[model samples]
Target: MQGPHPVAPPLVALTKRAMGGMRSVGGRLACLFGIVAALGACAVGPDFTRPEAPVPGSWQNAGDPRVSTQAAADSRWWKAFEDTSLDRLVELAYHQNLPLQVAGLRIVEARAQLGIASGMQYPQMQVAFGNANAVGLSENIAKIGGLPRNYFGYQVGLDAAWELDFWGKYKRGVQAEAAEMLATIADYYSAIVSLSAEIARTYVMIRTFEVLIDQANENVALQEKALEIAESRFRNGATSELDPTQAATLLESTRATIPRRQTALQQARNALSTLLGQSPDTIEPLLVGPKAIPKAPVTVAIDVPAAILRRRPDIRSAELYAAAQCARIGVAKADLYPSFSLAGTIGLDASTRGTASANLFSSGSMFYLAGPRINWAFLNYGRITNAVRVQDARFQQLLVGYRNTVLKAAQEVDDALVGFLNAQAAAAFEQNAVTSAQRSVELAISGYREGAVDYQRVLDAQRSLLQQQNDLTESSSSIATSLIALYKALGGGWELRQNDPVVPERTQNEMKERTDWDDMLGPSRPQEPKKNAAPAKH
Candidate 1:
C-alpha cells in the first residue's frame, strides 16, 4: 500500500502500554491455568475398585453335548441358523429399530453429560462483552462539583472465572459421568441382544403357525373324503346317517383351526414388523412365501457361568451403573472439603465529557484484575455427611442389584437349556407317534373301504395322526425359539455393534439442522471398560 498512516504520539504510546499490559496478564493467566491443572491431578475421596463377580465355575445345565464350557464363537447368534432372511431382518433391526435407536440416543446424552462434567474442571465463567451507554444526571441526583452533568462511556472486556477442583469434586463428577456413559453403552448392547432374539422368536412362531395351518387343511381334506364315503354308504343303505354327521362335524372342526392359525400368523408378522420399526404391511414381502421354522445348531457353547459377568450386557450395565453410583459417593465426599476459585477480568474502558468520545486503549482506561476465593461449608457437615451416606447406600443397592442380575441371567440360561433339550426330545417322540398314527390311519381307511372295519376306526386313526403331527410341529418350533432365548441369555450379538455409530444418519442430520451443537454430537473415542475382579482359580 501507500506510506504507513501517521500515528498520533499519544495513541502510539497508549498502544505500546496496552500491549505490554496484555502480554503481562496473558502470561500470568497461562501459567495459572497450568498450575491449577497440575494441582487438580490430586483428587480426593475413594478411588474406584471393581467389585468381584459372584458366579459359578460351570453352568448347572451344561451337561449336554450341545452345551459346554467353551464360549460362543459367533457374536451374531442369529447367523447360526444360516437363514438369509433372518440375517437380513436382524441387520435391518440393528439399523432401524426405534428402541435401539433410542438407546443410542441415550449414549449420546451420557457422553454429553461426561463432557459437561469435564468442562467443570476448567473455567466456569468465560465471556467477552462490550457495553455502550449514555447517562444524564438529573438536578435531584446526588452529585459533586467535579462531576459532569451528562457523559458517555464504553467498556470492552473479557472475564474468566473457575471454581478450582481443590477437593477433586469436579474430577469425581467426571468419573461418575464417564461410568454412566459406559453404562449407557452396555444398555445399548442389551437392547440389540434382546431385539435380535425377539425377531428370531417371532419369525419361528410365524413359521410354526403356517405349518399348523397347512396340517389343519390337510386334515380337513381327509375328513371331507370320509364324509363323502359315509354319505355314499348311507345313500346305499350300507351305513347310518350318524356316520355322515360325525364325519361332517370332524371336517368342520378341522376347518375352524385354519382361521385361528392364519390369524396368529398375521399377528406374528405384525410383531416382527414392529421390531423392524415399520408398519405391519411392510414385512409381508419378506414373509409372503412358505418358509421352514428355523432350526438350532445341535451343540451350543454355554461358556463358564462366570462369563455372564462379562458377556451379559444387562449384567455389565448393572455393574457399570453401580460403578457410577460409587463415584457419586466420592463426589459427595468431595463436597465436605473447602471449595476454591479463581476470578479475573481484563478490560478496556473509556469515557467522554462532550458530545461523544472514547480512548479505549489508553493507559488511564486499561485495567486487569485476578484473585482467589475460598468457601467452606463448615456449618453444613450434617447435611453433607447425610448426602454422602445416601450416595453410599445407593451404591450398595446397585451392587446388590448387579448380583441379582447375575443370578437371573444364570436362571434364564438354565431354563432355556432345559426347555430346549426337553423340546427336542418331545419332538422326536411325537415324530415317532406321528409315523405310527399315519400307518394306523392308512390301514383303517383301507380296511373300511374293503368293508373289513367300521368308519369309527378310520376317524380315530386320522384324528390321532393329525394331533401328533401338530404336536411335533409345535415342539420343533419350541426348540428353535428356546435356543434363541438361550442365546439372548448368553448375551450374544451385541459385539456386532462395535465401532458402529451411535446416532443414525437421519437423526444426526435432523439434529444438525435444528440447532448448533458445536459438534457435540460427534463420535466419542471408545473407552476400555473397567473389568470386574474374577474369582481365584482353584
Candidate 2:
C-alpha cells in the first residue's frame, strides 16, 4: 500500500469551510493521508440533453402519402419501382461499398468511446505485485551505516482511486461521448441511403443509353436504304448526281454516331459497376437493357419540418454532435475546481528504499502504506479557466454548424422539387415528340413508295424519328433520376439492416465481458425496418 498522493492544483483558492473552521495545512494533509479508508461513491457531471429539432413542416413538391415510419432510409427506396435488378444492385453496394463499411466501423469506435467515458464515473481498482532478491553487507557493519546487509522478499496488493464528483465533470464527459456515438450511428444510416440512391441513378442512365443505341442503329439502316435509292435514281438519269452525293453523305454522318454512343454506354456501365464495388466487366451485361425504369412517379408526403428532423441522418448526427459539445463544456468547467478523492492501497511489502532492499515481503516486518487523498489546484491561475473557455468556444461552433445543417436540408428539398417537376414535364413533351416523329417517318415512306417525294425526304423523316426516340429515352431516364433525388430529399429509406448484427470491432470484447455497465448503455434502437414498413394509410 501507499500513502495519500501529495500535490496541490494550481490557482485553486481554498475557503476552509468557514473562518473559524479554517483547517491547518497539516490538518488538510492529514485528512488526505487516509482518504482511501474515509470515502465512497461516484462523481458529479451533467447529464446530456438532446437538442430540439428545427425541421420544416412540408416539402416543396411532396406529392402523396409521406412515409412516417422510422429509419426507412436504411432500406431501398426503389422498391416503389418494382425493379429486381435495382434492388439487387443496392443490396450489393450496401454490403460492399468500402466507405460505408468504414462508416460502420466508425460507429463501433464511437460506441467503444462511450463505454470508456462512462467508466470515468466508476470506482477504479487495480492490483500489483513484486519480488526481489539481493546480497550485500553484514548487520554489524550495516548497523553502523544504519542498514541491513542482505534481503529477499515479495509482495502483492490492490489499490483504488476515485475522484469524488462533488461537481460531476466526468458524468458530463460520458454524456458527451454517448451523443458522439449516436451521431456516428446516423452517419452509417446516411451512407446506406447514399449507396441506394447512387445505384438507382446509374442503373437508369445505363438503361436510357441502351435505348438510344437502338435508335442510332435504326437510323443508320434507314439512311443506307435512302442513299441506295438516290444512287439508283441518279443512274437512271432521274435525279442529279449532286442529290445522290448529299444523300450518301448524310447516311455516313448518321452512322458515325453509333460508335461514340456505344463508348459512352460502355463507360457508364463501368462506372456504375465500380460504384457497386464490382469489376467493370461485371456490369456490362446489366447495361444491355430491358431495364425496368420507373415510369410512375412515387408520390411523396409532406411531413414538414419534423420529418426532416427524423429522416435525415446528417441532421440527426449534427444534433448529436451538438449535444456532445454541450456536455463537454460542462466537463471543462468542472476541471477548474479542486478535486476530492477516495484512494487506498493494501499490500505486502518490505522497504525497498534502504539497504534492506530484499525484504519487500518481510512477513516479520512487512511494510504497507494506505490512505485517501485530496488534491487542490492552487497555482496555475489561468490554465484550468482557459480550458473551460476553449470547450465553451468549441461548443458554440457546433451550435452554428447544427443550424447550418438544418438550413441546407431545407435547400435540398427545394432543389429536388424543382428537378422533379421539370423532369415530369420533359418526359411528357418528349413522348409526344417521338410519336409525332414516328408518324412523319411513316408518311415519308408512303410518299416515297408512291413517287410523290424523293428517297432523300424519307431519309430525313427517318433520321428525325430516330433522334426523337432517343430523346424520349433520355427524358425518361432524367425523370427517374429526379425521382431518386426526391426520395433522398424526402429522407425516406432509413430502416434497420440485418443478418447477424456484427458486433463492432471495438466492442466485441466488452460485449463478451458482460460488465455491470452493459445495462447502463441503454437498449440499442431497433435495427430493422418493421414488416409494416410501408405507409400504413396508403
**Cand. 2 Cα-lDDT:** 0.64
Against the true structure, what is each candidate's TM-score?
0.88, 0.76
List per-candidate RMSD values in Å: 5.1, 9.3
* Residue-level lDDT tens digits of model 1 in 220-322: 8877888888898899888789888988988898899899989999999999988999998789777744467887887777667777777998987887788
Candidate 2: misplaced stretches above 4 Å?
Answer: 1-55, 62-76, 133-148, 284-289, 298-302, 351-366, 376-378, 444-463, 496-538
- Whose lDDT is greatest here? 1
Q: How close is candidate 1 to the true structure, as a TM-score?
A: 0.88
Off by over 4 Å in 1: 1-39, 288-290, 353-358, 450-452, 515-524, 527-538
Model 2: per-residue lDDT, tens digit, 1-538?
3677443221011111221232453476565545533442333333334444466666545443333332333245588777767777877776667677667667666767776876777775555544554556554563545544554445545567777665666666666777777777778778777777788888887777767777777777876776777677788887789766887777788778878888987888887877876788777555443644556454443346566776788887887787777777777777766777766554555545465454433433333344455677768678978887887788778778888888888887778666767767787898898888878977886776566887677767877887788777777787788778867766666564533233343454565576533432332446321221111121
Please list the C-alpha lDDT of all candidates, in the order they appear.
0.81, 0.64
